[model samples]
Target: MKMIDLTGTTGVIFGVANHRSLAWAIAEQLGQAGARLAFSYQGERLKENVAMLAAKLPGSIIFECDVTDDDAMARGFAEIGTAFGHLDYLVHSVAFARKEDLEGTFRDTSRDGYRLALEISAYSLLPMARLAAP
Candidate 1:
C-alpha cells in the first residue's frame, strides 16, 4: 500500500475527549498519512486517554488546554511551537452544551448555560487559531 507523505507537515488538533471522538478519528487518519501531530485536550482527566492516542502516532505530543482559559491556551501553543516549531494545519471539533439547552426548549435555557455552551463550543476556536498561527 502506498502512504501519503506528510513528513514535514505539523498540526494541532483540539478537543479529543475520547477514542470515539471526531478529533481522534481525524488524528488516526493524519497519522496514517505520516503527519506530525499535537493533541490538546480540555481537562486533566482526559490527559491519559489523549496521551494514549498520541502514542499511536510518530512524534506526537499531548498537552492540556482549556480553550476558554487564556493562560492554558497560551501555554499549550507555546509548548507546541517549542516542540514542532511551526503549524501547517488546525482542526476544531470541540463543542459543549447543557442538557437543558440541547434536549429541551431553547427559551428555558439559563444565561450561564448559554454562555458556557458558547464558550466551549464556539468562542474557544479563536484563541486556539491565534496561538497556533505563526
Candidate 2:
C-alpha cells in the first residue's frame, strides 16, 4: 500500500492529553506521513509524559506551554521556530473550565471560571497562530 506523504510539513498541535487524544492521534498520522510534529503541553508532568510518547513518532518534539502564561507561550513558539524555522499547520483542541462550571448549573459558574475558559479556549488561538505561522 502507498503511504501518505507529508515529508516537508512541520506541524504544531495543542491539547494532546494522552496518546488517545484527538491531537495526538492526528499528529501520529502526520508523523506516519513523514511530517515533523511539535506538541505543546501545560505542565511539567505532561511534558515528561508526552516526551516519552511522542518519541515513537518520527521527528516529533514537545514544547512546554501554558496558554495562561504569555511568557511561556512566547518562549514555546520561539523554541519551535528555532527547531523547525517554519510551521505548515496547527491543531488546537485546548479547553479549560472548572469542575463546578462544567458539572453544576450554569448560573453558578464563577467569574474567574468564565474568564479562564474564554482566555484559554477561545482567545489563545490567535497568538498561537501568529507565532507559529510560516
TM-score of each: 0.90, 0.90
| Candidate 2 weakest ten by summed lDDT | 1-10
The CA lDDT of each predicted structure is 0.87, 0.85
lDDT of 2 by residue, 21-127 (tens): 87778888888888898889888878876887788887788988998787898998888888888889888889889787898789888999999899999899988
Question: What are the per-residue Cα lDDT tens digits for candidate 1 across 15-43?
Answer: 79889999999889888888899999767
Question: Against the hidden true structure, what lDDT does model 2 obtain?
Answer: 0.85
Residue 107 shift from truth in candidate 1, angstroms = 3.2
Candidate 2: misplaced stretches above 4 Å? Answer: none
Q: Give candidate 1 regions above 4 Å deviation.
A: none
Root-mean-square deviation of each candidate, in angstroms? Answer: 1.6, 1.5
Error of 2 at 1 (Å): 3.8
Q: What root-mean-square deviation over C-alphas does model 2 reach?
A: 1.5
